[model samples]
Target: MSEMYKKEVPLYGDLIDLVSDVNTETLAQQPEIRQQLEHSGELTRLNMERHGAIRLGTAAELSMMRRLFAVMGMHPVGYYDLAPAGVPVHSTAFRAIETESLNRSPFRVFTSLLRLDLIADEQLRQEARAALDQRQIFTDNVIDLIERFEQQGGLTKDESQQFVKEALETFRWHDNTPVSKTLYQSLLAQHGLIADVVGFKGPHINHLTPRTLDIDTVQARMQGKGIAPKAIIEGPPKRDCPILLRQTSFKALEEAVSFQNAEGGYDTGHHSARFGEIEQRGVALTPKGRALYDKLLNQAREQLGGTPNEHNAAKYYQLLDSAFEAFPDDYQTLHDEGLAYFYYRAVDDGVDMSTAISDLDTSASQTETAKQAIADLIEQGAVRIDPIVYEDFLPVSAAGIFQSNLHDEKQSDYQGPSNQQEFEQALGAAVYDELALYQRLQSQSLELCLLALDSKA
Candidate 1:
């Protein structure tokens, strides 16, 4: 998908090259961070495309997409309701859950299902639904292979390659659109995102995001590389200890598109949707930590009183930094306060962590005690704490990216209630809880650390 996206969006290839250079430079300058990443199995995957975003028009398409990703070892994790942020869609990121799979290939897709219910015009809603139901996003060959894999449990090497080749076509961009210019404009007026989803033959990948060690640096240098970037980066303010994810993107490209007319010819039009993005991921925070982060972020945004566009970018950033002063800036403080999850490594041969975890009780009343014991283990040099990288999406950030890249004005009042139950039903499976996944990883790493410590002792 990354290769195909690079070919489809030339700017994406440039973004990839720029990220590679920035990552190499960042690692050279911050050897300590590089060492920690290497220890945590994050180093090898840094230079590859981390994720891509695609918007689907129907539940059937979404359900099939889930199965399609399963063949590649990616499962949906975390339900994100972007409606609250004025974007009329709900989404989940599909990626490998296990550490080994992620280390091998961290590629993921942020797939969103369009909410036809959000459209106010009943007539137009029916029309959009009809259009969506009329299209099939997958190829016949890929569908056959999916069934074959389901029956056989696995595909041969040749079959696997064939499946990949056939599947890539599902996301390939087509210049000829299915909908007429009239319906496309109507959808665009409702929400640019709606038009982008319903106007195309397939849900063409909108953006390909590359993980960067220094996103701020990349943002600063993007213009120098002849890439036009959005005014502000979306997410938490920059800090010594970055939390969650920070993302910035190059402006969406305006491409010549041909809309099919009733007379069998086409009318030339243009679309502004595809872009390139870069992300800097930090430690996954505990629920308590996330609550505090959300509070601070909202406070900052409330103070700004509007969207953080180019006009108010500077002031918004200042308010953001001021608000986040309450957040812990160092990893040690984050760990000790239970503000973030950590992957533990047994670092010393002489030190023993067995004593700390032997009576570890995870009951609510003993949770703090268990945490303190782990703290003690670390203080005694028995364990090294590596921050667990946050591997999920934020609803607000996702919506912000869509709004900025889709040529839509902010609709702060356009909020939709979260319908995770409906979304899961359409998904054909329940989405994984992101926080629980991080907690499990932390616990698993601690268990390994305990075993290593016991063997040494």
Candidate 2:
């Protein structure tokens, strides 16, 4: 997929090189961070970290997408409503869920289904649906492979390679438009995003994001590398300990495309939707922490009177920083306050534990004494805790990225309602709660650490 994207968007190759250089420099400058990543088994996956985004036009496409991704060990986690943010889509990220599966290959794809119901014009909505119904995004071979895998429970080596080849065609960009130029223009007039979904042959992989250690540095260096970046970074302001996800991207490319003409020839025009994106992930926030984050974010936006843009970006960031100051910045404090999730591990020193047996008071119950000893060991740095990387997307941030990449004056006042039930009904399965998954990981780690500490006592 990267090779296909690099071929279509030449600048994507440069973006990959820039991210690689940035990662190398970051590791060199911050050896402690590198060590932490190594201990957490995340360092090995850093270089391979890549996530792609695609937009689907129908429920059938989305359901088949789920089956296709299962072949690669990816599952849908989290539900994101982009309608509230003014984009006409709801989404889920498909990727490996287990820790070991994630460590092995952390490839993810942010998939969204276009909501044709958001179109206010009744005639335009019919035309859009007609255009979408005429198209088939997946190849026949890929569908057969998906069905075979489901029945057999696994794909053979030959089948896997063939499946990959067939699946890649679904995401490949097609320059020719299925709808006529007049219909395309009508859809574009309603919403640029509508045209993007209804005008194309397939939902081409729009943007492929590479993980970065420092997004600010990458944003600062984009211009020097001849890449034009978006004005403001999306998500929280800079912090000692980052929370959720921070994202930045280069502007979408304006590619020349050919449209079907009534005269049996092709009409030449251009489309701007695909772009290059970068991300910096932080610890997954618990429900309490996420509520606090949402509260502070809304407060900042309300004070600014709008979203962050070039005119008021500085002031907006200042208010954001001040508002978030109430949130804890240290890992230990965040864990103790039950604000964030973390993976805990027991650290053993060379010293004999028998020498410290007398340190525990024998008068108290065994459970109480063991708990106190574990607390002391944690406080004394005998147990280590690492933040669990946030493996989900923020709806507001996703919309911000979408708005920035879209053509200017493409804003839509979508006052439609969010129908997650409809989305799930179309999805053929219920989406997993990301916060619950993080909580389980944190709880399991703490239980293991307590058991180890109790044995030592």
Candidate 3:
């Protein structure tokens, strides 16, 4: 997929190189961070990380997408509603669930289904549906492979390679428009996203993102390397201990396309939809921490009075920093206060048995003593706490990235409702609750650490 994307978008290869250089420099400068990533099994997967985004035109496409990703050991992890953020789609990130699978290859796809109901023009909505219905995104061979995998419970090595080849065609860019230019324009008038979904032959992978240790560095260096990055990065401001996902991207490419004309001929035009993106993930937040994050984010946005852009990005970031000062910055504080999730590991400190036993003596109850012992071990550097990497997307941040890549004037006026139920119905399965996943990971780690501490006692 990376090779296909690099071939299609030449700049993407450059972006990949830039991110690789930045990661190398980051690791050299921050050996502690490198050690943390290596200890957590993240360093190996750092360069292997790639998450692509695609807009689906129908429920069938999304349902089929779920089956397709399953062949690669990817599952839909979380639900994201972009309607509230002004993009007319709800999404789920399809990626590997198991840590081992993730370490092998953490390729994810941010798949979104177009919300046709958001189109205010009744005629345009129907026309868009008609346009979408006439096109098929997946190749016949890929569908056959998906069905075979379902029957056999897996694909053979040869079949797997063939399946990948066939699946790549689905995301490959097609220059020919499925709909006529007039119909494309009509749908474009409704929304640029709508046109991108319904006008094209297929939902080409819009952007392929590479994970970076420092997105600010990449964003700052993009221009020097002849790559134009977006004006502002999306998500939380830079922090000592980053929380959740921070993203930045280069502008979408304007590529030539042939639009069908009424006279049975084609006319040349351009479309801007695909781009290069970079991300830096932080610890997954608990529900309480997420609520606070949302509250502070809303406060900052309300104060700014508009979407973050060049004009107010500095002031917005300042306000965001001030608002988030209330949130804890240290990993220990975040974990202790139950604001964030972390994986706890028992470390052999080589301390004397007498010292370990002496630290356990307390006036508290038996359970309290155990808790205190564990806390003391952590404080005394006998236990290590690693923040669980956030494996989900932020709706607002996703929408912000979408909006920035799209044409500035092409704003949607559709103030419609969000229907997660409808999205699930279309998906043919319920989306996983990301918070629950994080909670389970955190709880399991703590339980293991407690058991280790009990044995020590």
Candidate 4:
């Protein structure tokens, strides 16, 4: 059954609270919970150390992820895709979490998965399609568990414990199938995993992205380590601006995966599907703030092409600042003007500034106050450029990482243009309200991680 149909998954924190009231003090005494949280923390650290590169090959892979993390008391809240860029195939989905609490730990990995079967070509596409068509992504059992929890509002203490164990055990299953040399390549040709049930091998920790205060440093460091980082470190170019997300990666390592070949044989060989990806996440944007940010990006990209060199980054910022001067910032301006979807604040100074300004030559003076505010902030180091987080993945970058690690880009013999909507519809997912999704996940993550970390002490 689809996740949507299975049952309503409670928002992350509610699910946790339902299981048990994890207050700051109570969590500290729970050793098991503490251990699981530490494990999560370790995963975050690992992602930063190596870069984030995890593969989610199937529905079971996805389900196992939700379950395994739930063992650590996590939940799936948002869905994202990068295929909308519409070029070389790069469709990955993720759930963002606040890795640490403002009062607690650091931020967690904004994890992504490789959409292998969504290739744009034919030969390998068939193989990928065949693999997915033949298998089930989520099991009835997994659905049942989630359903029960959602309905009951919480699992009994014993049940929650068992759920965690089963969740972990499910993902822990590995490809250990024994096979002969002749059959090895055959099975490898047919499937990517040693186990045929899930079709592809079980999911591995693909990438563990760490929150970098300075992505340029990490990018340079990765380069020093011989990893050719991503071409563009996404986000604002200004050093002082708050960068949302800047990511880079070394080449994907040729990690050995259990591959079953034809003639019912198995062999261990390396595949380059997984790569190290690192990111620097910035402040969560309010809905209004996000609109302004996106508009700024669009304006920037239109003025500056794909690879925004240093010169281009500077140029783009200048253009944005100019546009912003003539425009009211964000949805707030839209609301104030009776233009947008969200609410706004109205400041009644008890004086009609419009009437006061109606007589004087105010054209030149109109933007003076706003400009001064920006200048003041900048002068005081209060206003920083909002770094463009890697909100959308670059097709070349995605394909570049895949190509460096894959056998081939699979000879793009695409018959038609890619349809993002069709793909998302099949998954029964909607284009997420980015602002709302980010807030919900971050708030819950802060609550959960803080509680978990506190307990560890």
> Cα RMSD (Å) per model?
1.6, 3.3, 3.0, 13.6
Model 1's alpha-carbon lDDT is: 0.88
lDDT score, candidate 1, position 432:
93
Tens digit of lDDT per residue, candidate 2, span 12-85? 89998999999999999989879878977899999889999999999999999999999999999999989878
Compare the candidates by lDDT and give the number of the best one.
1
For residues 33-74, could you state the per-residue lDDT of candidate 4 as single tens digits? 344334334323422222223445444454445543443333
The TM-score, computed over Cα atoms with residue i paired to residue i, of candidate 1 is 0.97
TM-score of 3: 0.94
Residues 284-403 of candidate 1: C-alpha lDDT, one tens digit per residue: 999989999999999999999988899999999999999999999999999888899888898875755566767565343127777777778878887799999888888888888899
| Candidate 4 Cα errors over 4 Å, as ranges | 1-81, 84-126, 134-144, 168-199, 223-232, 284-425, 428-431, 437-457
| Model 2 TM-score, 2 decimals | 0.94
How many collisions per candidate?
A: 0, 0, 0, 33
| lDDT per model vs. reference | 0.88, 0.87, 0.85, 0.41
Q: Top model by TM-score, which number?
A: 1
- Estimate the TM-score of every prediction: 0.97, 0.94, 0.94, 0.51
Q: How many clashes show up in model 1?
A: 0
Model 3: colliding residue pairs: none
* Cα displacement (Å) at residue 230, model 2: 0.4
